[model samples]
Target chain A: MARLSSENLETAYEIIARYPVKKSALIPLLHLAQEQDGWVTDVAMAHIAELVEVTPAEVIGTCTFYEMFKRKPVGKYVVNICTNISCQLLGGEELLHHAEQKLAIKAGATTADGLFTIEDVECIAACTEAPCLQVNYRYFHKITHGEFDSLIDDLKAGTRDEIPAHGTLAKVRQHIPAARRAGAVAPTDRAEPVWLIRNRQEGAS
Target chain B: MTMNDVPKIITSRFDQGDAHTLDGYRRTHGYEGLAAALEKTPQQVADEVKAASLLGRGGAGFPAGIKWTLAPANVWPRYLVVNGDESEPGTYKDRMLLERDPHQLIEGVLIACYAVGCGQAFLYIRGEMAHAQERMAAALNEAYAAGFVGKNILGTDFSVDVVLHWGAGAYIVGEETALIESLEGNRGMPRLKPPFFPAAKGLYMQPTIVNNVETLSNLPWIIRNGVDEWNKLGAETSKGTRVFAVSGHVNNPGVFEVEFGVTTFRDIIFDPKFAGGIRGGKALKAFIPGGASAPWFYEEHLDLPLEKVAIDRAGSMLGSGAIVVMDEDTDMVKAALRLVRFFARESCGKCTPCREGTTWMEKIMQRILDGHGRPEDVALLMDTADNISVDFMWPPRMTTICPLGQSATTPIASAVMRFKDEFERYVGGPIELNVTVKGAAFIGPPTRKKEGSGV
Candidate 1:
């Protein structure tokens, strides 16, 4: 069965340690699983379930609820085009059409060479930068047809080194130093909150 | 006064390219609020913010300080969850804050943590915001390294830790309770209020104060300069400057900070320094006073001040501080369909009315847009909207649990009622079906393909 690599397991443990309840780490762990592979596999879900101490069905339930997590295999680059109200007003629909024609695949389909996937997404919070597209979650705001084509060309030719693969949300991972961590003990392990004990002591004094 | 005359409090460091960096932030009076806040007791800090009357910029316009004081007194381990999961259709101010001046937000988070007696704060950014997440994460790490966060911040007794959590693309998580649910590794479905209010019983069954990123970003300025200075700005009820993210058919569509209650919808849309009027010198047909959820406002309503009360009286809200202008050329029917389709897609499917009703509304609107509208289709759209929201009035009476149901009704009700003639034009026989995919944007049970139809 597919599982997180040893290094990824270590990083997963670090993330789980940040939350009081280990289950709170479920989303981040799922992201990590996706990061390991482009799409989340059943075995990866099972692995995350075991790590987060939830059932595979529970994991799948949470996973399916979000729009980002892909169940099936996808291309390396996921091109999400915003076609909501603001973007639509500024030719978002036209851009989506243009992308479909350019890529020779439909909105939800991956390319024949398994390099790119186009999706007509809703608002991605960049309303000001209308008609925006994100390749592997990296933004290309206010893109024209020419810019988009050039971007695609760059992606195909491996010239756009700034953009990463589909699952990589950020190139720079967050690191919390040991001294700075808020005691991420399991909630059940504590009789009462640590702050409560301090508060009680201060009040009594 | 114009926007230039208004002080840029929260967005002070926006133009500074290095504001996201620790050094850049320090050079520009950063962390001064945190310093000022630490000098006062937590109660004192809370009191000052309450006095300042800083309203939440994440839509609802509730006072941030008042929200902080609502938690049961001395509730240990009270959590401060910053709502950076900003995916509102026309809202992007929070995104700018996240990407540009993350340290400012971090400082605000630290101050808010101290004020609310929280030992830990969870910063939930949106999944699609990769740049924002990176900027915020980098800023947070720099802050921790500099001792602004985690364990005796700035050599003071007060210590707070902020965990950076990103959502997996659920707009429903923007709702406070749904955000809490998402934080707890559950499906991002909103829990019913009364028993499940975050202030009373929240994350891990303890008290939590969920604040908008923009709301928290105000804390530093208020704390540094004092409430008197803050009170000098804005109107009587709504105090402080608000970051208005203006978009759509405008010449210069971007985020601008203006003193709240002073500016009008017209000033925001037409002012040279702001949106710079509509694109292509076109006449304004209609504009969303706020985010997509608010009812559309026409040219007559342009004079209304950008105040919560004034806009509310005019039958719409300055929701999420997003102003999307629509020009004369925009097809009202198609525009309504665009927004309706958004609500339907992002309904979260928790409540039956919102899930089913929004889909129905989207379908009917799509059918009309597809030139296959029946004569009664407009009434059908209104009927479906009425079913979702008990009435088409402002502050809609909802049949569903969350406001998402009522939000679906706004575009249809606003568009159909105001421009009945335009909706009528799409009716009768098949007009030019420009849309390639019939009902492709909507989500529901798939219909059988019609002959020669673009399915």
Candidate 2:
């Protein structure tokens, strides 16, 4: 077990003080220690217990309670796939399998190269696009087996760069002049067409 | 929003009778829970609830009786806040209860108010959920017209009012304090904990009891069915039936009430009576045992029971009982990127780590996905995550202000930890410019401004 650094202890106390119930800040404090050390160790839990004036059992209990906190060391990149109702109906299961096979690691296991850790997540709320996944924090929607393979291949090949610029509503309006007009298909409605078309296209294939 | 409303639990009582209308509610068993409670001692009501062993169904499996008992008794004009803002991604069980069974929620609210000595109850719904708002409002009006909601209910001196408030469509508002803030007309940012426990100081500074839609809905049933009977349905630690919204990779995806520990992932996912497994014999890739923020589970964890304790042991959570399944043919990097995008967008921007961390993480993810990543950037991404996580520990305690801030890094941190190779694969690659914009922007004020302006 790694020693809980003084810095992490101080940080934990600071968080506990901010909340009405020190226990409430437990999740965030664990996040900090894990962030600093790359994982939550037993030593860290003991320090958090001291900071929050709770028992080590309590700290560990809360840590083990939530899914977000990492008790063990993880890989460098986490692939979170959405396999909820919407994403499932949209082929989330198949996409997940493809990812696991391509990465050569089952979901929840780090790759042999220590480069990737794949996880399955619940609904991302981008149901309209369906079958979505998040590499790090960016969303890739309306994915297909081919698209999924290509995304991994591109990541592997290091051929894709530059974050997709956030396209403002204005940019969307510029593309479809009718969008700016009143009663022009609502932006949400307009957005659905692409995904719907993609779904149909994939279905046809 | 339609006439084909199905009466599940609460609505069954209101819909079958004229109780949906104010006059009808008066004639029927409207406010009966409150009336029953008012006749008995508050302690007795609390005891009954405790005996019921009812647990909160809004993600955390907190005991309802324990929550009510925690409220400081000295505080007057206490509040009973109902969290109707069902924003936990893939968890729509509450919406069904709120829209179709509003009266049940109302009765449960009144009972909870009476038990906790609360004077008012507020139902905070997401701003986007206009239809739910309408149905709830109409239900409240009916209760009021029937003399259940307004002053001097049933000729007893006790009076309580149920108010409906709309949120600005923020997922963070689902947090109790944040919901209180939004109800109070502030930006829907979550407050720091320790001194902010809603039971002690909530709403406009008074003791409060915040329960989720499903939790409150369960109250009337608990009262109807003794705690022992309710506890008989599930595990000893987690008693009673829970409503799970099963979605993703299932033949039939909908909400089903199953006893705690009585169901398994395979039973739900592969059972023809339930989800019936992934479509078209597609192989299962991963599964999110809870809401979006919960850690992912692979096929190895399939037989794991879909219960709080079981999932927790598996390094995941049974969050809101929203089981999202992913199949083969999915990209791990892209999936992680999508979740990161959600955290970035949904972040209330109150805490530095969450606000900047989520945005930066999204950017890094995008770069990797777009094929513009550098090998060293992988470590940089980890460093950035480390920095944000440090910030995540501040403010609300030296971390971000609320669960939103802390949870914002969940997908990114987990992804980077679990899928580093996939991220490394994207390093040193030319950017893939195959970005396609699918839908019109969601109907909301522009979150990002034109270039040159301070975003």
Candidate 3:
């Protein structure tokens, strides 16, 4: 299915308008596209390229470089377990092993029904909450085995509604008035905007 | 060293539940700093920051006011980029400030943007910080609606537009130059020094001022309280309270704000007000005094001061103010391996020394952890690390475009030096080679010859 539907186009343009240059919105636009689909697809990448006015290769370069973007289909719920130094010292590795045993699948693998995918990720800057994990970017502080199992059960039963689907980044959308939106200037053009020139500054775009 | 019964700067507001909201922030005297700041000229505001003894809360601990002055004078439209990508393994005070008291950060941003005459600013937050990002984005909208941002901020002739950029998932973006490159829409790889420094030519090729989230977060407090009050909080060389993230094997493993040099590593670990001592009554074996990048410290060095120069003189650093505690049961080799693996994954494949050196060390560490280490491997590991490392010289030499390679090697070197006996146990032995393979099986050293009939 086409990920970036016509309904999302206006919202996409508003996001694009937030940057002085079109390419600067590449990452945010990718978040919007992923918000529409569970993971980034070739079609969605193409759609993003068209929306942001960049080549598909450029979009893919930015997308693949970041670990958050998934190239293939992800499970309904992506359980990202943080196993960096702080968490590792506090049973982060054991937690991952426990998860593997309970799920009957290794990390980076999804269940047969495709409800969950366990990923051993880098630090989320939440070192204070060790043995911590995130499901769809929502924190499950100091997660224990029992809590983990019940969380999986909750996800399987479709009971956890606080967090959105796998690809959704935010609960709120940004709406910029057309007048206040940053009009995109060509990369080749060195011409400055009235506001920038009024401040005696050259536009970095 | 300056000490108080409790912290007065950032942590003073932590008890308030609704501090994240604009109203709650105002109730706690948040935006008053920005209001007080707007009354003065940009240079006057800059002078007040210079008058204070504030050091960058980020690992580097560079003078924040000095950084503001480095932004090119003739260049107009200077940008202020706040590095909210707090991905260092043991460091996380930025996430706390962003989530708990967000408007304070926004107010700080407004003030910093004013001090440097930056018409635009960007908050480059890490991808995993969804809640932090959500709060910050909401705060920005609140700021715009309340006239704290946008055209003619606070009825002053100043106007600045702040952009919130989310990192997909690269730790290298924590570097200022790499952050700028990422904000411009590319891979978050560190740029070569010389011409690519942010202050000289930053985002979109303009003079830029990049500060840490916690560093800028303190600006509001310093601007409101005046320079003399801040200078009284820490050592002669260092000033103000730093919010430290205390994690791993500690009873009260959380963030703590303590005046620099006033508290020792011992106090941070055992003090009742801080981390209530190591968990389970286990003796402390070693600790990562800084984030993962800093060299590990042993139990004997508990008396070391928390000041940057003191810690640096002690052969470690007070990096990012992240104190990761380790108990007697902790495995130094395994811990070092995890750190190297983190760097390997987040290396960004930029310059040779970092990219190749990190992955190479990961493989070597994996072999060592797997009990396949040879007597020569320990020396080999040091050799590999030395190739990427830079000692504390005047210029501070480094092999990579960024400091990632250096960080990747720090743990290995320190762990090996402090725990040489541990490495010896695995030496002169081969791991279970036929070991049941699972997932990406043993991607051995690159130099491993192509064995077996080219099947």
How does each model score on lDDT? Answer: 0.84, 0.63, 0.79
User: All predictions: root-mean-square deviation over Cα?
Assistant: 7.4, 21.9, 8.4
Candidate scoring better on lDDT of 2 and 3: 3
Tens-place lDDT per residue, model 3, B1-455, is 33446456887777899888888888989799999987766667888898785789887889999988887666655778899999888888998898888898989998998877676778888888888888888887777777787767777667777777788888888898988888888888777878878888888887889899988888888889888788878777888788888999999988988886667888889987889998889999888888988777766568766887767655667879888999999888899999999999989887888889899999998998898878788777877776777442212257777788877877776677666677777775422221121111012111222321010
lDDT of 2 at B86: 75
User: Which candidate has the highest DockQ of all?
Assistant: 1
**Residue pairs in steric clash, candidate 1?**
none
Q: Which model scores highest in TM-score?
A: 1
Give one digit per residue, the lDDT tens place, for model 1 in B1-455: 55567788988888898999999999989999899987776767889999998888898988888898899875566788999988888998898898999998999998888777786789999988899999998998999988998887888667767899989998889999999999999999999997989999889888889999999998888999999999988888889898888999999998998989888777889999889999999999888878988887776677777788877765678989989999999898999998898899899998998999989998988998998888688777777777777656667775776799888878877777667678878896322221111111121122422311210
Q: If scored against the real structure, what TM-score would every candidate get?
A: 0.94, 0.63, 0.91
* Candidate 3: C-alpha lDDT: 0.79
Residue B377 local lDDT, model 3: 85
Best first by lDDT, ranked: 1, 3, 2
Chain B TM-scores of the candidates: 0.93, 0.85, 0.91
- How far residue B230's Cα lies from its native spot in candidate 3, in Å, is 1.1
CA shift of A192, model 2, Å: 53
Q: Which candidate is the best by lDDT?
A: 1
